[model samples]
Target: MRRSIFETEHEQLRDTAHDFFLKYAVPHRAEWEAQGHVGREIWRQAAEHGLLGLEIPEEYGGAGIHDYRFNAVVIEEAARTRSGVALTLQNEIVAPYLIGLGTEEQKQRWLPGMATGELLGAIAMSEPGAGSDLAGIRTSARRDGDGWVVNGSKTFISGGLLADVVIVVARTDPEAGHKGFSLLLVEDGMAGFERGKKLDKVGQRTSDTMELFFSDVRVPAGNLLGEQGRGFYSLMRNLPQERLGIAVAGLASAEHAYAVTAEYARTREAFGQPIASFQVNRHALSEMHTKLQVARTYLDQCILGVSSGELTAEDAAGAKWWITELEWEVVDRCMQMFGGYGYINEYEISQIWRDARIQRLYGGTTEIMKDLVGRKLGF
Candidate 1:
């Protein structure tokens, strides 16, 4: 399917982004994976390339483009190259929240550094007990004289080790249910802000995921983002873009998986003939092609709708759940086609298959997405 969403400008940006990934990211994949995180220099290199702040305002060291398709392009290419942490997520997932909700003083203090890669950002939302149930989080911030005393724990935080500033979600008023939540920015070097061990994960090996502990960590009143007790609403507002981003990567992974498997099938032989010549292999290829094409068409339209501010949360949820689930399915089936070789780390398919597992789990689970969609339908 032909995608009409991107203009010539976006196309040019894609080419540039693609080249950047190939040069800086592809060569370091193995080392980064071995080190358990991407090198910090890559973040600086990306900032030099003007890839970190496309949505930020011009005065704040960004391109000032508010369009989402440009953001989508960066994520798509990053996933295509399997770029590691602090590349795609910093720009697409975490940056926008600060851009959209942070105060002018906050923006002045953080945006320039963020764009220049002098500062790294991470959002702390998921707790050990609460994944999708935002209202159930027990992390609390009690009001003090001139600041808030924040004490809590956050697990599964991306960029946790490298984050210079973390936007933490906590309950400001325990009895208010959803209305009690708020967002606070806790900077590095703050007293009593302790980082836990980097977790061992099944995939996304190079992306640092860590646990964070706040033991009487005091955040200044000015560090609060938006209205106190309004963080849930704020989270809800931004979740659509997050889901859209996941959808972008999910389908891209599917397409890449299919492409790689197709190449392998053509070269590997069975019964003195290429596996690609077999009817079973041909049928599998046909099905994968059809599924990916349909998913791509839908996701491209969602990207356009998001760029124009016409995309709804329900629409994004549907795309995220359906497309990522499809990515998991296609990658698994494609892996099976490789026989035992698919399970080996040396094969790119194995890595992709492992990496694709979180697609259905993160950015809200497929079950949560369906529930959101169901609620939008008045269920």
Candidate 2:
């Protein structure tokens, strides 16, 4: 069960992150949940503590560490703590687009603020008409003199409510089909950019989820990310990393669930003995533990594959679907050990269960991931 992924530095990072979240983030979870969004203060605090932008360059106010394991440590610690902040959304989902695609001028304008956590980023993909169907996206950007005029809306935008910069996916050439799509950087207070109502979700209440409205907003040509009409491919390239992030989160949450449940079974009694003393309960815990270890092994390989640029979309899809589905089962089984307390909103397991549901849905639905992998297998 010992992980070979972390070096001494990685463990050092994990220890510091664990301590910081235990002190700062865990204590504020309730208050942040009440607001339905994490405060910018927490983001700034994380940055000040040197936890927010490990992948960004030092010139841009970051540690300039390119290792993905370091990134995984941040994500794993966040999930383990149930911090309710979507660091994955920022670090895994949006940072690459900025780092890999941003022009020197664009980097100058945005990267420093991002690395410093002064600017939060979000990638707007799903629309009112498109969730899994990227081809169905209706958000459009038309070429205007010296700029592009964008018009459309995005929903289910993670980190939307507070993002200082939103990387919007829009159709740039109506006739080019899939190649028509492009990424546009829409900054805060852009003339026609508006944050819609904060969505009320069943879980992960502290992470902001919302709709975004863009009405004939003029984005300077300079703000376009990557080559125009290459957005779809760009997004596809990033999907592997994004899905891997989800898988790691799934593993972390499930592991946390198991730890909590195992401790409960050891202490909570039934028939004058601990519930764990029962054969059926013991078997259930054993199965969940074995499943978790297996999951970690494969996921660790996927992490290494991704870090080495050798992980294929198919491999990432397999990890995302299998691990998330297993995550759900593991958490559900763990919750059963708590009996009625599992259903109570007060228990930590209850929140973990609620939050785990979306893992299979977002990034890519389990069904979609299966089909993707199936197709790659000559199905």
Candidate 3:
């Protein structure tokens, strides 16, 4: 399908992103996975390439481009290259909170380094006791004379291992219910702040998932993000863009998986004939192609809707759930076509399959997304 969402500039960015990933990320894939994370130097190189901070204002050392398509382009290129550097965690998830709510002094302190990749950021929301239920979070921050004393832990933090500053969601008023939550920035090297070892995960090992512990970590009052006791609402405000990024990643991964598997079927022989010549394989590939085309058309419309502020929470949730589920299905089918080779780690198809499983699980699970959309429909 012809996508009308991307302009000439987006294509130019796609080209640049594609080249950078191929040169810098592809060759490091094995080493990063083995070590459980990408090298820190990659971020500096990404900054040098003018790729680290497209959405940030140029005054803060970024391109100042607010368009979501630029994000999609970077995600697409990363998926194409099978590179998992967690760049989206920085650019897509954490950047918006700082940009949308940070005070002038806060912005001055953080945005430039974030743009230059000197300061890595992560948002700690999921606690051991709370995944999607914000009300259930046990991480508490008590107000001190001039600062807030934080106490609790976070699990499943994507960029926790190397985050220079973490935007932590903590409960500030036990009696205030939804209004009780607030965001606080906890910088590295703070006393009693500890990071657990890198988690061994089924996939995305290069992305650096880790556990974080805060024990009476005193954060200055100046570090409070947005309105105190409004972190839940702030999180809601950013979900549309975050889920949009997830949808982009899912679609790109599925497309790449299909592309590689289809090419393999054409060249790999069966009974002295290409496997793709078989009716079953041919029909499967055709179905996948048609579905992907439909998905792309819908996704292009979503990209435009989001950029223009017309995309609703329900809409973004639907896109995230439906598209990620489709990605899992498409990759699984592609793996079937590869037979035993698909189960082997040496083949890229196997990696795609492993990574695709997390799509339906993260950024709010498919079940949660459906419930959100369902509730909005009065169901």
Candidate 4:
């Protein structure tokens, strides 16, 4: 089914993003995967093309476009190339926090570098003991004489090794329970702020993920984001968009897998004929195509809802888990169709399968999303 949500300008942007990825990311995938992270040069190239900071105001050297369709285009095109650069994290997740909550001075200090890819951003929320339970975070920031002293560690922080600045979620008043959390800006090279080794992952090998440690790191009072004691609320408010972005990427990955597998079935022969001629393969393809179409339609609706400010947390959760689960299922079936060849590391289907596993686990697990939606339905 054709998607109707994007305007002509969005298609043009998609073309630009596709060309940029093909030129910069596709050829370097092997090297990047070997290094366990993409090079900063590609990020700078993307910034040159106006791919970063779409939400930042023009006065701060960003595109200043608030539309989500542009973001969806970048996600889709990046998925098409299988680039594990984490651009969605930069544009979709972290940008909103800064653009929505940062003070004018903070904006002036950070937005330009963010827009130009000089200052990459990462949000540190999950800890070893706390993944979905935001209120259980133990990272603490105590009030000091003109600054706050932060002390804690975060694990599984994407871009941790390369992030120029990290927005650390810390407990400001342990007695206040959930109301005690606040966000502090912790910059690179700050005393007592250090990054641990890059983590080895099952997939998305080209994206950097690591541990971050902060001990006695003093953050100025001006580095505080939004109102104190409202960090949890701010995270909740931005999660819908983050989940929607994940859903879009999941749908795109499924679609790409289906397309490539369909072509492979038509060419790769079994039983002295193309596998696509077999009833089982034909039925599998038909089923996957139908499922992907349905996912795309629903994802499109969610994107529109988000763009129009009508999307709810429950709705985004539904889209995230359902679409990502479907993505994993579709990719798994596609891999099976390739038989022995799909098990090989050289095959893209195998990588897609590996990468799809993490989608259900992150941005809130599938179980967590179901619980969230169920509660919203009063179950």
- Candidate 4 collision pairs: none
lDDT of 3 by residue, 236-353 (tens): 9997789988999999999999999999999999899999999999999999999999999988888888778898999999999999999999999999999998999999999999
**91-154 per-residue lDDT for model 4 (tens digits):** 9888789999999999999999889988898999999999988888999999999999999999
**Per-candidate local distance difference test:** 0.90, 0.92, 0.91, 0.91
What's the CA RMSD for each of the models? 1.0, 0.9, 0.8, 0.8
How many residue pairs clash per model?
0, 0, 0, 0
- TM-score (all chains, Cα) for each model: 0.98, 0.98, 0.99, 0.99
Native-structure RMSD, model 2:
0.9
Off by over 4 Å in 3: none
Instruction: Write candidate 1's Cα lDDT for 1-379 as tens digits.
Output: 6788889989888888889999999899889888888988888888888688888788999889888888888888888888764465777767888898999999999999888888899999999999988877999999999999999999999999999999999999999999999999999999999999999999998999999999999999999988999999999998898888989988988888998999999999989999988998899899989988888888888998987888999999999999999999999999999999999999999999999999899889999999999998999
